[model samples]
Target chain A: MTAKQNTQNSLPQTIFRRKLPKLLLSLFRSVFLLGVGFVMLYPVLFMTSESFKTVSDTFDPTVIWIPSSFQLYNFKMAFDLMNYGQALINTVTILIPSVILQVASCLFISYGFARFKVRGINFFFGLLIFSIIVPVQSYMIPLYVNLQSMHLLNTSWQFYLQALLGTGIRSGLYIFILRQFFKNLPKELEEAAYIDGCNPFFTFLYVTMPNVKPAILTITVFSVVWYYNDYVLSGMLLNDHFPLSVTLTGVSTALNNQLQNMAGQTLGADIKLLSDAILAAACLIVVLPLISLYLVVQRYFTEGVERTGIVG
Target chain B: MAASTEQKTKNKPKRLRSLEKQQRSWGWLFLSPWLVGITLFFVLPMFQSVLYSFSKILITDNGFELESVGFKNYLYFFTESTTFGPYLTETIWQIIPSVLMILAFSTVIALVLKSNFFGRSLARAVFFFPVIIASGVVITILKDQVMMSGSSVSDMSPSYLFQAPDLVNTFSQLGIPDQLLSSITTILNQIFDLTWKSGVQILLLLAAVNNIPGSFYEVADMEGATAWEKFWKITFPTISPTMLVVITYTIIDSFTDYGNLIMQMLQDYYRNNNYAYSATIGVIYFVCILLVIGLVNLICRKFIFYASE
Candidate 1:
């Protein structure tokens, strides 16, 4: 009986040790992931591909699979209508300053929270997070009233300056991320700086900031993406002064008009094709920079999230 | 010689203490920009909102005019306003279902992705990319193609697909009944409402899962506990802090999104100088949110096992 039981247990162990099941399981998981991934990525691909399709081919569901011909003229027309050059300049104008200010202010505040043992720091920090929790929409009316009172309404500077003051959506997430990183850093390095007669500010500048470079890069990329794509607030702040995102809306409005006038135009197919090209061109112009930034910093951003130990 | 040198050096710092004080003063001085920004911008303005919530303001050729109203705004919200009750109810109604779904879906996704598998990283990237791209502007730009103006997305397509009919038709032909189809559609619609919106919660859940110690799982195996038991005992407790974070994040995210039509109504009210009605509605919605958060916290406290320090 003992021999038989030993053999029975050993038989299953031998089968479990085989590599086939694990490999099959992994293959199954991969296929499932790929299917889901395609589903997720389809919309993006559809929008991009249709941009290259001709106007008459656009509504033809059969042609949706791929563009028959890559007509680049649609892009030219779209660019002209949207004033892409001017909008790109305006976008950069806001993007650069807003990014710099957001990173700088968040760095200081996060450093303060992480390094100092000041009284009531926790309370104040909690309040800051509370501000983040409240819907920004809730503050819109009040913000408008205050800005109107400041006589800063309807100016480009209104968006730029409000963002620069660490009050933008970028700062909240950036500050939280940076603080988590700062908290995790070994205190020995700053202590060594102190031993070498360096003060807290200098130590932070030379030692801490350099160490948190990944987090800083993450913040920079995040700010560019968030502030650049913002339309609702940007819409309210800059009346008729269109950024790239806003210009996309303006172009959409124009496309609808072209669509409406299709019946009268002799060159209806060409016009539709032109509209398709413009839409694709516009999407490409706005999305390409951010996507590239994402691809470059993708590894660092993921690594930084884990390193900061800020899963939440 | 060592003792004498140490003592002398310690005394040296005290001798130059006045200079040290001046140097230290620069810390606060360095902080002056933040101080000015917070006081004038954040602190002062926030207080002004609270004040404005109670009082009515009238614009003039001169600076603005203010009329003191005590409890009138609060009373209107609780009592007589037509939209205030329904608006508060609708906002809360949307928030609860949205948050619950976010928690359930994100938790499952995080749990599945936590396993070591092929293409896991890519899967995560795909999941996260929507959040990166789908801001208000991107959505607004896509609105013409994705949704029709003056249509409650549900009414336009099927209330379930954000008006994306192609996907719905595919699902329907899978031999699903109309009622079952409708329910599935509603769920899909809700999922669409919450997916990109819950990025913060997903990150939190991932953090919680990562924090669970491997030793606990090893011990559970030694005791002959099943995989399910290990999950129940070890994984669940470890991630409770993250659960709180996700809950709080989801509730606020769903509530404050500018896409909500009711919020737009509130905005219109304020723009039209209907301050009293807007404040009443705002305060009601604010209270409802607080109550929901409080309930979640109370319930979770029972199960959130904190490791003994």
Candidate 2:
């Protein structure tokens, strides 16, 4: 396949001159993409494989790619060990409230910046950007002190407020994103609403909000993913009371301890089967929703981000 | 013209009469929640942290009193010589390669994903999922699994690429000099090896690519420009602002590693009641961040294209 005649060439010159190279190009591209795709999927695949394997099989290098026998007990064990039910509830409890507050806060803040010429507006904007740039560590000392003083330790509200408010601007990414979205809205839409005698609040909700549905959804999905997968803030605030990721850590450690007892023995079939089932069940419960959501919003997420001027 | 100006004034007064006072008052309504949250959580703590940097934590019978120590704490870090300098340097060195690799890899992957291809969206999601999942604990678990023991994150293995020995062996088999091959391998490894933890950058890059106007590319195509030319002219400028942002983000994000400033402060603050040291480090880190973000802003102002403008 000469370079000149390679059908894989996407250049304009070859478009009219050759067809074979295009076919070859597409073939090469698919293969390359599939290879990279597999690499990207490696972690999830490994986790899935580990979830189905018996306790003994998990560490065995040779048996990794395929399980000798499907054991479903691992999922059950993981579930019980992690207190999956409580953690799931706790996760939803924290995620829903936090995301709601964050959405509201972002809207109000960004709307003010976008819609009005408030005094010291530039100062406020600079403060917001500065807040984003300043690492969370900068305020951790004081925030921890303040939270302790407020006696909000181990409380769900602590997580909610920290995540929800402008306080823990750690999610400056979200704030920045919302600000950009608000700025891009046409003033004409709001002006038309004003002409019809709609107040600012009603106008924002009825006009601007409807138009930025895609941005809202994108932010909602991002907040969900961030909050659901969140362990750090949960760890910092919740102090290990059944946050989902915290529960996973707890269960993994417990399982590590249990592994020591079963070492060097081909596990008796019953125990192995039980452990495998438990692990599988836990992985399914934890990962299924996230993967499904990922698939659903995957396109919107990319498209929304691109419109926000994220990539050049 | 005079009659129209009188009509405009009359119409404007009616429009303004109902809304002027309400508008001035209601601007706070739109901004109040954020303003209150910031005042309570952001404004107070930030200034307090700055003040706390100059004071020593006293563990007297009075629980957690602060004794004003002037610039002693800051001096200890800046001039009196603590382990801070070496740790700062080590952390900075770790941040540089990690951030650079993330930028390069994300740029390449974003470019590839942006091209018309089957399963492009899936590829983007796979790459972006890591950003959402790669929190502190997740990174800790990943590090435990992948990183060699005793080498902190400073010792990065190029991600999704061959390790040094394999690359060296391949080059040697091809009759290349060991020294020459080694340097080339080193550079390539630095450039190509991304630490496999760049999900955030990938997402940001994908966003940047999506933001590039199709009209710019269409015009370039009409002008008979090459693909390379189109990228350099249209794609690069439009996305340069984001690159600055993401790069600054990656740099600052790197500093938030578990062993660095944030985690260190958390541990020391809780365990030893050392607010002064923590505050000092926090200020230093904040200043470093401000400097980096300032640089990024300066760079961005030069190249950020505003289509509306």
Candidate 3:
């Protein structure tokens, strides 16, 4: 067919005419996408660049994209002001165990929804969806009052307990995702395990769980990031022990206090540059770990997203 | 042999019933965690919140006391309060445009990224990076920096199509309606914020697009279908279910967004020891969100394609 078309017209002209629109379209797409990519990355890059800038360079319009000179003092100042080490430890302490517990509990709940034939199961599932739709703030005041009465505030137990019960932030969505993944799995594997005298619990642990690793990973990533980024819940719950997110929010005041203690000066009108730099440094410190984690697990992140979407 | 087979068949139904009962027990057992969670975290709190919304909550050394007010808080919100009405309207306005913009922008971007173009994977990673660090703290910090730097946000971040002012001017010269012009500029001005929020939606859409069976496309190609035809015919219908999911997610996310004015107002009220008012506002906001979600689902239901089992 191509040879006949070539005979009907000069081959080179025909090919050029055929390819011209496609080439133009591809070029347009590439430029547009790249431009959008730059826009997406600009804030992070700006944050990074500003984090290292000296107070003078931050205000210098000429030094827009990059710092004229990289200064380590801002990081040092931010670290001391934000109590970066302790906050990081606090964040990890709260996030890691909660992520594990949430993932495990959600897996169990989703497995039940996916595999078992229970009466009124759809009603129960509707409750899960309700949990997702209702905003946390609506119930937060009551939850806070209850926790205060129980003296459960200012501890990791609040997060851990919720996670264990499969009610932590976005746990409903996680369960929904995992349920879809589990439903799509072939029933033959579980049947085979059952025929070999495996109980349901053992079958779930050894058979179903292993096959849904991608979904598990996806939920874990989301759980970790969401918990890490959470401020309102953590801020309300923990008073003495603040996570990186809560600490970052208070960095400005902390910086002001530190300046007052060090030089007997307030964060008055003239201190915008130093304050901005310090805040940017604190923001970077807070986000660095998650960024590195995402970079390391980029492949699994994308795969998990794809798998969840398909199953969902 | 016939007597034995009949006996076995009779036993099979009883055995199956027992097995079904066992499965039901196991299912409830597995769901025990969620049941407890729902009761304690969701149901109890929701009940308490509703009660609190209807009463005046006074905190004392011993504990808090709730005195029944019976719709006074709701009345104040509706008739007395000056800020709630505007804030609610502002939130509704914000929700509609942002959700629509995100859906449109993300679907197009996902389609573009779905194609096998050069550096496509890298482009995807770039688009998805926001989801990893889209915390309220980070966004607030970045937004503050952008404001402090004395550069317009549109200048710092690329506008969706063109600078709002330029687009508005051109459209005005072209005699576009005032209403249309203002709406266009409002959406364009929100392009930066919309882009950030669209990251997850884009990923979801990209995944959905990729999930379409290749055979469908091959068949379309064999039929000499144009790219546009293929998208409208094959791609759109196949991905509509995921599109519904994305729309719901986006709506919920936008309503509860940290930067939302209503949320900020509610937080302020709560901080100022106005628990009843805060709870009232929370419930109102929640009902609004539910209405929006219901409306969206109803609209999308006609188009969503659920594959028959």
Q: Pick the candidate with the highest DockQ.
A: 3
Give a tens-digit lDDT track for model 2, residues A167-266.
Answer: 4435566666666656655577677888899999898887878766656766677677777776655666666566677776555457656755775484
Supply the DockQ value of model 2: 0.33
DockQ of 1: 0.22
Candidate 3 Cα errors over 4 Å, as ranges: A1-10, A115-117, A149-151, A180-211, A260-269, A303-312, B1-22, B145-178
Place model 1 in a CAPRI quality band: incorrect
Give DockQ for candidates 1 onward, in order: 0.22, 0.33, 0.46
Can you write out model 2's per-residue Cα lDDT over B1-309, one digit (the tens) per residue?
999999998998788755655675667777676777777777788888888888877777756677898999878877876667777777676676677778877787788878887777666677776655555344344334322221112233313333466777888999998789976776665442253456766665666677666777888889999988988898787666567757766776666665564457545654566767777777887677677667767866877764433
lDDT of 3 by residue, B115-226 (tens): 7877766787788887878755887766755344543122443222324677788999999999988888877777777888888788768766876778889999999999
Model 1 lDDT per residue over B179-276, tens place = 98886776676655566666556655765576566677888999999878987888887776567667776776667666675677777776787755
Per-prediction TM-score, chain B alone? 0.73, 0.74, 0.83
Off by over 4 Å in 1: A1-24, A114-117, A148-164, A176-218, A239-241, A257-263, A267-281, A306-312, B1-35, B55-64, B68-77, B111-116, B147-184, B203-243, B270-280, B294-309
lDDT at position A215, candidate 2? 64
- What's the TM-score of every candidate structure? 0.76, 0.79, 0.87
Best by lDDT: 3
Better of 1 and 2 by DockQ: 2
